[model samples]
Target: MRLGIIGVGHLASALVKGVLRTGFLTAENIVLAPRGHSAQLRAQFGCTIAEDNAGLVNACDTVLLAVRPQDAVAAVSGLPWRSDQIVLSACAGVSIADLAPYVQAAQVVRIMPTIAAQFGESATLVYPALPQLAPLLAALGKSYELKSEDHFEVGSVSAAIFGWAQALIGASSDWSSDKGMDRAQARALIAQTFISAGTMVAKTDEPVSQLLDSLATPGGITEAGLKHLENTAAIEAWNGAADAALGKLEKRR
Candidate 1:
């Protein structure tokens, strides 16, 4: 497949790496835009740059918009898009309605993914206004189609956990300092814990309560910790976060 990626930043870089490993798209077949857009990814993907967006658009069958949310409009606003071109976007808050007027393609798909995609473990929530595009993006990772645009906001909020996560690592690192544990080890430990938990969720169909029950035996340390977290308003904080994101999504629309 001939693919053109607009931006080659962190997430785009991760995608190119995984795409190469998965053999869905190769360096020779993949055309890229300038590093001014996806600088880091261009360096790592080892693919030829398209010189410009139109150059890539004209050359490739499938084009992915991997640019930042703000850049998306101006980047593609003046370009001549083709009906045959399929668009898979990783931009948050930009909807299919917002995109339709700018491009010639009838197909558009929006996906929310985690940084874990670099290693091939990603939790992706898809909001495709066009049902036909679902199969096209399946190769990227686990994808889900939601009934409404409102669903994307929920995932958008979920994706924002990256910021909070880094903060958590820093906080934990500071806490571990007096114990002589360094920042690197603390970061690695949290990274492993996050991945392991994600793996468990992906593999199991059972309820999370049941999963927790399995780990939390009576009077156990895990149970004690869980109880403390629950008491400390973590659940409430998470709920507010999701609700706040949904509100923001509504306002964006």
Candidate 2:
């Protein structure tokens, strides 16, 4: 199916790349748009670029709205969609109700995805009321059809508010600088540790407590570090971040 993207930004570019890289669409099938970055997307994805928003809607069967939250209402309100078209929105903190007045399309899927989608490893959460579009969302990530709009808001918060990883990384780089480690090596080590830890979590079915116990060995360096982390309130603070993020999303709409 032809996938027409409204915005040719980073996440949209990733979706375009992933679809083509994974053989979901052909160069002739995908259509981008009248926006400023259309040339870049056309170059990156080798697809035809539309000259206007109406042209984008008319060109494709499925439409992905990837613009920022601030621009969502005005952008979608401006689109003219056919009844046959399927709309999938990636704007965070914006509700289905927010777009309902703008378009007359039958099926609309609300999605929460991170930039990992560029590499096909995005943690995408879906709340699709229509079953026909269910498979399409599942292709993005492990999809979850939330029972209520409240939970979707919760996931939306988690998706947008989880950027504190940047804060953690920034703090660690400073510490490494103090230790005489150059910026490059410090950044590489930080990245490698995060990747390794994430891989460990993904591959194992073991309870994290059990895994940590094995590493700690009842007084080892891992245990010492773990104790220090707990005492310093790092883990608790991270939970606070997620909670705060959820609260913000719930208030937005």
Candidate 3:
């Protein structure tokens, strides 16, 4: 499919790399809006660079909107949207309803994909799943479709969680290094540990709590750490952070 990208920022750039790497779309088939990293991408990938947003919209049947949350509406407004066009928006906290009036005759779908898309590992989130976009989404990584906009908003919090996970990994790696582990080894070990943990939960049918219970056996190292985290209310704090993110998203609507 011919895809147009309105906001060619970091995340959008990663997605461009992802789709191209997977051969989901060719550089010639992609159209990029003129701002942000568009020029760099065009030079590097031989992708088409549109004269303007209008030109980009006119050239492609499916458009990926990746502008800032506040700039999303303005960027899409007055575009030459067609009845068969699909607009996949990655702007956090912006709802399809908010773009409906501006993107006339076009289908606006909300999507949240992380920078991991660059490695074809993004756990992309989609609302009101469109069958036509499945292959594109799958090329980046696993895609989860939320049942409704409300659930999509809740799922959007995973975007922030992704960064938090990275931060935790970094901190853990540093701690390991401080304790005399090789820096590179520590980083790799910590990162892979996280991947393994996530893979276990994702690939198994057993409840998460049960899996954790098995790992955190009585009097074990895992149990000791779990006790400490619980005593320090780490889980509660994590929930509070997620709640705060959800609150901000709700306010954006």
Number of the predicted model whose TM-score against the real structure is largest = 3
| Model 2 lDDT per residue over 1-253, tens place | 7888887787777667656666656778888876756788777667898878888887888888888878887887767788888778888777888887787864577888776665666677777656766545544555667777778887776565436665666678778978999988888788677778778887999988887778787768988888999999979987887888777676768
TM-scores, each model vs. reference: 0.83, 0.85, 0.98
lDDT of 3 by residue, 1-253 (tens): 9999999999999999999999989999999998999889988999999999998888999999999999999999998899999999999999999999999999999999999998999999998899999999998999999999999999999999999999999999999999999999999999999999999999999999999999998999999999999999999999999999999999999
Model 3 misplaced regions, further than 4 Å: none
Question: What does the lDDT come to for candidate 1?
Answer: 0.74
> Which candidate number has the best lDDT?
3
* Ranking according to lDDT, highest score first: 3, 2, 1
Give per-residue CA lDDT, model 1, range 154-243, as digits (tens): 767767776676676677667777578777887788777766876797799989889989999999999998899899998789788778
TM-score winner between candidates 2 and 3 = 3
Worst 10 residues of 2 by lDDT: 134-143
Q: Mind sharing the TM-score for model 2?
A: 0.85
Backbone clashes for every candidate come to: 1, 0, 0
Off by over 4 Å in 2: 129-145
Clashes of 2: 0
The lDDT values for all models are 0.74, 0.75, 0.95
